[model samples]
Target: MIAQVKLAFGIAAGFGLGALTVQALHAQAGPPAYVISEITVTDADAYNREYVPLANRALAESGQRRLASGGRTVALAGEPPASRIVVSVFENLEKARAAYSSPDYLAARAIGDRYGRLRIFAVEGLAQ
Candidate 1:
């Protein structure tokens, strides 16, 4: 519950600021792009299977617009910093944060506790 709240806040605050930053820097051609890696650490494939579908449903429901190319990911194998499911996205920091709000993202996150310690991080200043 606590982690979910933090994730929600992170998305709202991070993206709100990121959007503002983009607007402030509108002089640039476009929003500074980032390669977002929505990842989770897990040792069990069962966890991955369960989480991915739920998270996908949430993502489909939210409809948060992302300049991003693809979608979210679920942990496939191993453990944190080792095994992970990485999804790709191209959006400002604000959008990055917002993506977490996706039912897909949140659902996936919830199942995280079913496994070992799990987490998701947005890689700032990334590409591809």
Candidate 2:
């Protein structure tokens, strides 16, 4: 009887350790996120010269890295795409939003508002 009890206790301990390890791994593998922006610039020159630099600075400050940016887009499907598309990666959704909402970025965005329209979204990335 004592041997059986010891074996049961050992099994329970093993399961507990396994659960902890899985939890730790999950935490360590925190998923990344992305910020996507579709822009249609009415005043291209103003957006490029005045807004881009300031926006980049703010995004960097908030730990966002521009993954891709382009002024021209070719849509494979769906309705016509925006004139410009930009994708930025961040640690997570919160950081992405924070970057876009930060004062510096907001200021840059205001300038862009005067020159264009923006459609922005945050998306959670696949697990690493």
Q: Write the per-residue lDDT of candidate 2 for residues 1-128, one digit (tens) a residue.
A: 99999999999999999999999988886788988899988999998999989888878888888888985578798998888999889988877878888899899999889888999999999877
Candidate 1 global lDDT: 0.56
Deviating ranges (above 4 Å) for candidate 2: 1-26
Model 2: ten consecutive residues of lowest lDDT: 66-75
* Count of clashing residue pairs in every prediction: 7, 0
Off by more than 4 A, model 1: 1-43, 60-80, 85-87, 102-104, 126-128
- Pick out the ten consecutive residues of candidate 1 with the lowest summed lDDT: 64-73
Alpha carbon RMSD to native, model 1: 17.7
Candidate 1 local lDDT, 31-91, one digit each (tens):
4334334334445676667765676565555443334322443446764333443444434
